[model samples]
Target: MTYLCLGLSICVSIPTYISFMYIRTLRLNTRFIIVRNIVLSVCLRDLMFLFTDFVTSLASKPSYLCEVTGALLQYMSTCAFLWMLCASTDIWLKVHFPYFNHANNIYFYRSLSYISPMFIVCATIGGFRSGYVDENSCWLSITSQSMWVFYSTAIVLIVLISIELAMVACKTTQALKNSVQPANIASTKDPKQSRNMAKSFLPLLAVFGITWILGIFLVIGGTIIFDLLFVIVNGLQGFVLFLSQFLFSKQVHNAWTESKERATTRTL
Candidate 1:
């Protein structure tokens, strides 16, 4: 999972960074560009979480060190998913509202996304502290209360992502069905007739959705299994999901390459 997540992070972060760069370089509207930038930032968060997870995964006796690295991992993993929830909410707004225009700046939206999590973090700080460091390994294991917190957070994320995926799927299916012609060669012909925004969205959406869904299950299973094995499988599952997103798509690769070039030029 560690490798998978890191690989996915590299895969996603690079292209997301590039795509935003390309959008900025183009004559795009400020608002649309801002939205894309927000999404790119979320991908960056995912990468950070992946790195943190990879580190924790490598350390010996990870569970014993839940106070330091484990806390960091929890923060990253939780926040990354929350950021994705931001993406879903943003996209859902775009789809549902379509014209509820507001002049709120990018900072406003970004701040909005972080504010809720910050509150939760603050609440958690006082209420649910990791009491005894297991001292076994570098993995994470909060108290049963924290366990519940983590579980709840994971469930919320699963639900939110699932909602986004379902929305995307329904929209895509409808669009494709609408586009199909009557029973003729044209319908199943060599050349395609049309494509909808929903269709264009499916590949990325599927990557995002499927990976997380599969990942959450793995983590749950790991937590239930014997201690040492739990960390291994859970971490592995998270990485798998992360990697799956990037591996299953090509555009993500292109975007990543572009971002690297831009970063290189800046460094030079």
Candidate 2:
């Protein structure tokens, strides 16, 4: 059942990743970039999961693979989560400070995206694989001291995610106020103004807040229940992780819908 669930997620995620990459070329946006990052993160993490799941899948071999792949799994996930933290921060700042966002749209931020992704991956692979293998895959296996490091990093991600979400909320409130200003009547250019300014990016926001909080709590609490609850949460995390990949396609669908509408109206 576990493998079945995971297989289904990969099935959905593979095409979603391909679709997001295609959409990236056509109609890119911050939301798409964020989603794309998450998809890639999952892609890498799932590869580790597949390798490890094999040990768990068949005869509980508990192979010495964790001594090797363990670092990649941890690093990929940490980088994935950390990059997610960065995305939330970037988007929140962008929403609050449009001018700053315009700066990011130029080139440097684009470069950061590429560079930072690989940096996180390598940093993980290099830093965390000392004495981390026990019987199964557990953080304690990383070593006595590393568990603290893991928790500390988790705390950092939580702090960053929290701050960014707060910033975004504040921006939403200010946007609402600006949106309702007395003189800002709904005129011809208002469509563009409203479309650009509303900037809910609600799906992206939900992905940020929901996934982080849920995963953090799971990681923190996993040592306690450590059995049924932990497994269930991990299962759900897999579901949520893969599920977020689908949102990237919504914008593509929106564009297509609008295009079709325009074509129909023109023909009529």
TM-score of 2: 0.66
Name the candidate that leads on lDDT.
2
Superposing every Cα of model 1 onto the true structure, what RMSD results? Answer: 8.3
Each model's lDDT = 0.48, 0.53
How do the predictions measure up, each by TM-score? 0.55, 0.66
- Clash count in backbone of candidate 2: 1
lDDT of 1: 0.48
CA RMSD of each candidate after superposition: 8.3, 5.7
Tell me the spans in candidate 1 whose CA falls farther than 4 Å from its real position: 1-8, 15-19, 22-68, 102-108, 130-139, 171-268
